[model samples]
Target chain A: MSDTKTKKKRKEKPPIEEPLLAPGHRACSGCGESLGAKLVMDAAGPNTYATCCTGCLEVFSTPYPESAWKMPWIHSLFENSSAVAAGIEAALIAQGRDKDVNIIAMGGDGGTADIGIGCLSGMLERGHNILYVCFDNEAYMNTGVQRSGLTPFDARTSTSPPGKRSWGNKTTKKNLPGIAGAHGIPYVATATVGYPNDLINKVKKALKIQGPKYMQVHVPCPLGWIHPTDQTIEIAKLAVLTGLIPIYEMEYGEVTRVRKIGKNRRPVEDYLKPQGRFRHLFAKGAEAEEELEKIRQIAEDNIKKFGLA
Target chain B: MARPRPAGYVAEPGSSKANKTGSWRTEKPVFLHDTCTDCRICVLVCPDGIIFGADSIYDADFDFCKGCGICAAECPVDDIEMAPEVR
Candidate 1:
């Protein structure tokens, strides 16, 4: 009998695995949105209260009889997660328990950048002590792929399908981070699902600050974007490396930190070719070249504006 | 008699654990622990949050893993591989 085996195994530390988001959620495999939510929730920790708008997160995490959230969470209307969070903040303040509680409002791009913009602006303007996270997958994913205000230029959706005369969506992504910063909030940042550590850091940083904070996390959708399920993180990284989705932070209307792409910056085609939504942009024609050049210019503009080089 | 419903609200948190999402997988990840480092990158990137364990002893909970192959795809040391799920 080998007594050394028993002695060596005497004190191995127990595994620590307590996710704030429980399993069995209906989010698709390799769903970037769910990963983003889990990262955010894990960062916020157990002593948090959250409100989710009616979008992919809310629908998938909380069906009629079950909820995946491990904290006190509320599901409200499609356009009022911010309002619900504001109300919760007010109630907590009146009860003198606001200082110890972390409040978060979660939504998809359609809920945050489009339909919910009014309430979100109000939440920011009124200086509510909360963090609002917009998981931007670039379209209205829960309701079949429809175009959203935050959808990037020339990306095809059900509503913006490319035809002989059409080049998908005509408008560029809305300046959401800029709009949030213009309100002069305490903290505003952008993150992506590919970089989990960075995403967690931003969420933790936002919770520590007082007053309103905003974070827009770029989440890839396997079902909607039509990329391979395993490539969610890879595609998300491509978005940043190509300098399209600028990762930066603002404090009180001033830029503080920007994730530099520098010499490792990649071309837009590496990103666009992988996504079916951007497939039309890669067609062998003058229109495709024109659209790609426009997308490249947009990335270059972002690099120049944020000093990402 | 009808069940007593109070304003259509759920009191239980994390109840989705009963849904058994693992059945959705057509492929499952197999870990080669010998080549594994203690990076925990696979644990962090898992969308389902079902990969558990600390250090180099990590493994996925097959009860909920949707087998997205992210763990294998993102493994820095090539410690994980996606294999076809066997009946």
Candidate 2:
């Protein structure tokens, strides 16, 4: 029995001897962003060069004296990671080594959706051979959980607190993938940390395609979202399962495939109730029910729009 | 012997294993090898990289395991159990 079990385990285990991103970085205990980034790195492999914007990933992975990256990595300014990646790609082409290496630029929602969108748009429009990855944790988590352009509707943040006059962030999450798709990139995909295999496969697929590519991965922030540290993966999965976040792939401004939620579709409440940022929606009385209805409608719209059902 | 080093760039990768982050846990996951199906899903999903062991004989290093229970949640066999830390 023991021998059989051992054999089965060995077969199931992944061959991960030398990870591109070495283990030993200063990320939070259950940070999905770091884990998701690690998955992306593992998929991209050693021959890839990555550029990061000033955010949690940049701060934790490449702290001045120490770095977790085993591959060539660069830390660019908050609004210029894509620009730096473009420059790197241009330099690689000048050396006639462009085809040999994969270029990746990564940033959080704050950097990607807000501050860095211009450079990102320029890189896409210019058709740079780089993959832009946005690890959307929904807010600016590194700077004490402030509201960003990607922060969901009615969600509480340090800047968008719920009080008498206001009811958290009044804005909806920006459609970053849509914006990237509008640039007519070669490939675009949306993934989350919950589905590691899918995320890895998407990264691998994106890397193989030439020209500009974009992948937006939903990384659940335990600190910012105010959920149990262990439930990071669970919460991320729930976001997709509830249709609040759609998983799909696009090519040249058109969606090529959609990862359907199918029969196990969950209600939006299942995703919102666990997060403290959305706790106000579940407060006393039916005052916030209207907001809850609006959120449900958003999910329904995503389900219909992406054909997730 | 002393030598002047070049400025910029980290020469060596920092090993976070030296920092025992287990104290931050309010709950801990206890692995039940008997019930474990040897799927190894937990090993792949663990963010801390503390869960170690090849095949059926799997174990977590309490010194570094922050008890995220990602292993438990990802376990296809439901072998790992999350118990509250006494201390």
Best by DockQ: 1
Model 2 segments more than 4 A misplaced = A1-15, B1-8, B14-23, B83-87
Per-residue alpha-carbon lDDT of model 2 for B1-87, expressed as tens digits?
787764555446434334456787778888888767666677667775566776566887787667778888778878899999888
Candidate 1, superposed: residue stretches over 4 Å from native: A1-14, B1-6
User: lDDT tens digits, residues A1-309, model 2?
Assistant: 456665553445554353555555678878899888888987898899999999999987776666778778888599999999999999999999987689999999999999999999999999999999999999999989999999999999999999887789999999999999999889999999999999999999999999999999999988899998889989999999999999999999999899999999999999999999999888776778888999999999999999999
lDDT of 1 by residue, A69-184 (tens): 99999987999999999999999989999877899999999999999999999999999999999999999999999999999999999999998989999999999999999999
DockQ of prediction 2: 0.40
Alpha-carbon RMSD of each model: 3.7, 2.8
Model 1, position A176, has a per-residue lDDT of: 97
- For candidate 1, give the lDDT of residue B2: 100
In order, the TM-score of chain B in each prediction is: 0.88, 0.82
**C-alpha local distance difference test of each model:** 0.93, 0.87
Lowest summed-lDDT stretch of 10 residues in model 1 chain A?
A1-10
Which DockQ value does candidate 1 get?
0.54
True contacts kept of 1: 0.79
